[model samples]
Target: MEECCRLGLAKSIGVSNYSCAKLSTLLQNATILPAVNRVELNVAWQQQKLIEFCKDKGIHVCAFSPLGAYGFHWGTNAVMDSPILKDIATAKDKTVAQVALRWVREQGAFPIVRSLNKERMRQNLQIFDWELTDEEVRRIRQIPQQRACTWKEVVSPDGQYKSLEELWDGEI
Candidate 1:
């Protein structure tokens, strides 16, 4: 990736699912710092420390599963079905998805929403028009944080990461 960046083949390099610990090591050795770090982020699984570290390093935090990946194989209804988010959406006259996306944006991260439906895609873009209240954000901050994607198939006893804690560098 450094070679690609130096050669001008790729304008910038980005990493995915990298913890702050891994990024610290990468920053030490990398000639070219990563432009972005993509990770699973949502109201429930907010990696606040990681976000701050990346912010300090000037690395953009791109949120994957910003809506909690709801209605998908590895997704759960925890985000969309959250009582707090639902209440906020109700008060704002917006959908739960919009509230969630807005929250992701409000955190100074770019949300990567996956949707094939045209209307849904259009609705996802509506987040930028509004903002979450401080109280709403506080309520969201109190929601129990847990990683939704376990990635059971990737982490193994024989693999580099023996457990979730190791895989997430204890950020989980």
Candidate 2:
């Protein structure tokens, strides 16, 4: 890394899906703050502590899958079945999907939400006009911290980082 920096071969350095422990190690060895750390962040998996830490240090956090990935099997039925978000939608006069997308925008980082529908394309962009209250933010924060996607193939079965708990540095 130092060699690259010395040679000016790279513009900036960053990481993806790294825990605070790993980030701490990188920071210890790096002279420049990373430009970004890409991570899974959305209504379902907020990663609040890491987000706060990165903000405090002026490191950019780019959220991946910020809509909580609708149509995935692992997502809560509440994500699909509940009328609660719909009620909130009625209050906001926006789509439930918009509420989910807007929740992430309300946070102080960039969210990369994706969809195949053109209507969703338009709805997702409607977050600027309205906002969620602190209580609503708290409620969104409490929506059960579950990763919509986990790749077991990345770690050995008996490895020290075998579980998501260990991988996330006990912060989940």
**Per-prediction TM-score, please?**
0.97, 0.83
Worst 10 residues of 2 by lDDT: 74-83
lDDT of 1: 0.91
Best candidate according to lDDT:
1
Tens digits of per-residue lDDT, candidate 2, 1-172, equal 5568669998877788876777888889888788888887877687888888888878888877776656666544444333556667788788887787677677777878777889888887888898898877767766777776675455566776687777767766
Candidate 1 lDDT tens digits, 1-172: 8898888999999999899999999999998889999999999899999999999999999999998988889987889989999999999999999999999898899999888899999998888767888999999998888888878678989998899888888888
Off by over 4 Å in 1: none
TM-score, predicted candidate 2 vs. hidden true structure: 0.83
- Candidate 1 lDDT for residue 30: 93
Candidate 2 lDDT at 32 equals 78
For candidate 2, what is the lDDT? 0.74
Which stretches of model 2 miss by more than 4 angstroms?
1-10, 73-83, 158-160
